[model samples]
Target: MRAETGTRARRPAGPGLISKVGIILVGIVFFFPFIWMFASSLKPSLEVFSSGGSLLGSRLEWSNYSSVWTAVPFARILVNSFLVAAAGALLAVTVSLLSAYAFSRLQFRYRDRLFLVFLGTLVLPQEVLVIPLYIMASRAQMVDTYAALILPFAFGAFGAFMLRQFLLTLPRDYEEAARIDGAGQLRILVHVIAPLLRAPLAVVGAFLFIEYWNSFLWPLIVINDQDMATLPLGLQMFSGERGTDWGPLMAAATLAVVPSLLIVVAMQKQLANGVNLGGFGGR
Candidate 1:
């Protein structure tokens, strides 16, 4: 009995050596591309690939970063991306909150079927909808405008579906109690439900912001003027008949990653909780 107890006590408390090594390997695998981008940003255009995957170049080429600003209307591009992403995220979150409340809390006829139909829209790819969206935007005279960038995709069903799933998992007692106190639907959603949904809302908002920030194809199809181009479109300026300015392109990319990276890092905890409780795990 003593020997058995001692053996059990001697077992490792945390992940074993192999698990730790595997985790480290996986982290490195994911982080290596970012490292390569930053490293290549500091390299000469010619030396970017000629170094045979080595991170360091002959000398640190800080001018690549400077060249990025001069090579394109980068400032305007960054501003446009930030505005479009921020607005799109806010609009998406608001719409999701209202729609989720309606589907989950306030029921009418065939609500479940209606919700399932709305949810089914998620299966449709953006590429499939782009053509019709472009036609509508053209008809509305919104082409090359910020509205064209933001409005077309802001009403996606993903956010509404995710929020509704979370609402379904939530107890209705609080809402009922609020209703008894004569709280209106909008007031209940804003004051009661919205507060409780901070984590999931943060997750949805961050996802939307990242989606808008990194959007390339839709923006490319809609935006015609160089002044209105977003960061992803602006990056293309580095490539032309002269071939690609790899160093400057990487520099711009590294800069472009900062905002999304900061958002993800800031909301990391919320993101984790949202995934765990937001019905994303088959809950």
Candidate 2:
């Protein structure tokens, strides 16, 4: 009895010294760039490179951030990026929910085949679609518009595939009960299915928002007005004929990362659950 009690009461083993060291090294490797960017943001433009790989400069330059605001119409560009990202995320989620519902629940001929064909689109890179999308947007006269920024890439297969996988894991018992109660497809989707989809929805929304937030090439091709320019395009304002403004550019980049960072942090649990539930882990 004493031996069993002692064994049960013994403290659990913690990570080894080597494991702790490895974790610290891995953390430093992952976090070094952010630390470097923030440190460089406070340095003088010239000192940004001449600081001999040191994190700090000769002195702190708070003006770098103020320069970011005055050097370009940053506030407007920030608003525009936020608007586009939010709109794109909403649209993507709505479309994904509908598509996933149809694919996972509905009985139709060639449905799996059609889904496979749709999933094949995931292999197509954004670069290949840009030309055709640009032409379509041009014909629709959506150039230099928020619609152009948010619409072209909104209907991607990624969200649909993710949501569909999640939906497949869900039992049809609730859906069947809702149907027996005379609830329609859309009603069951909205009232019955959607309430259960919070985690996956949050994951999809966060990813789509980040994708739209960081987009540069498509917006560069489509938007002309500085007023309509997103953060990625706006960041280029730091580079002029005089050469690149490193300090202010770093400041702006840091500022740009905040929104997406907050979203990921806020949705951390949902994102983790969604990933695990989406066919990767057993329920």
Candidate 3:
């Protein structure tokens, strides 16, 4: 017993030197692609994909960013992307929160059947629906407009289902208590439920933002004007029948990656907390 206690007392304290080195190596492994991307963006176009087999080249090309700006409507594309992604995420989260609250809390006729019907929409692929969506947009004269890009994708069945499941994990005590205090449903939802949902909702918003930001096909089919193009659509300018512009393309890609990266970093704490707090649960 004394020997075991002595051994326990003598145990090494913090992470040793080798452990720190191992952590650094692991970090490097994970971040090497990002580092290579930034490095490649700085290289000259010719050196970007050269057989020299190095992450960097002899000459750095500061002009790539300038070239990219002049070569395409990068500013407009960035704005369109920012607007579409931000608005789409906001609208989707709003729809999700409201519908999920209703489905989880309220007593309504055919609620279960209607929810099942709503969930059924998830099985339908976007590709299959785009043709119909396009025809509808044509009828509404919404094609080639921001509404065409943002509105169609704003309300997602997946978001509703996800939020509903998360709501199910929460206890009903607070909601009931609020109801007993002469508060209406909206008041309870806003004051009681929304506070507990901050972490999970942030996580959902981050994911929806990323999804909308990186979207390609729908926007491609919807918008024909160059000025209305998102970053993904703007990528076509970098490629041609003859060849591709590697340096500027890399720079543009790096810029496109930054917003999503910032969103993830900003919401990382909420993401972790939400995941710990039964992020996934449903009856």
Per-model C-alpha RMSD = 1.5, 2.2, 2.6
Question: Which candidate would rank higher by TM-score, 1 or 3?
Answer: 1
Per-residue lDDT over 139-255 for candidate 2, one digit per residue giving the tens place of the 0 to 100 score: 999999999999888888999988888888889999899999999999999999999999889988999999999999999999999999999999999999999999999999999
Full candidate order by TM-score, most accurate first:
1, 2, 3
Tell me model 1's lDDT, rounded to 2 decimals. 0.92
Off by over 4 Å in 3: 6-30
Better of 2 and 3 by TM-score: 2
lDDT by candidate, in order shown? 0.92, 0.92, 0.88
Model 2, residue 146: C-alpha shift (Å): 0.6
- Tens-place lDDT digits, model 1, residues 78-197: 999999999999998999888888988886999989988988999998899899999999999999999999998888888998888888888889989999999999899989999999
TM-score of 2: 0.93
Itemize residue pairs with steric clashes in candidate 2.
Answer: none
Best by TM-score: 1
Candidate that beats the other on lDDT, 1 or 3, i.e. the better one = 1
Once fitted onto the true fold, the runs of candidate 1 whose alpha carbons sit more than 4 angstroms away are 1-3, 14-16
lDDT minimum window of 10 residues, candidate 3: 9-18
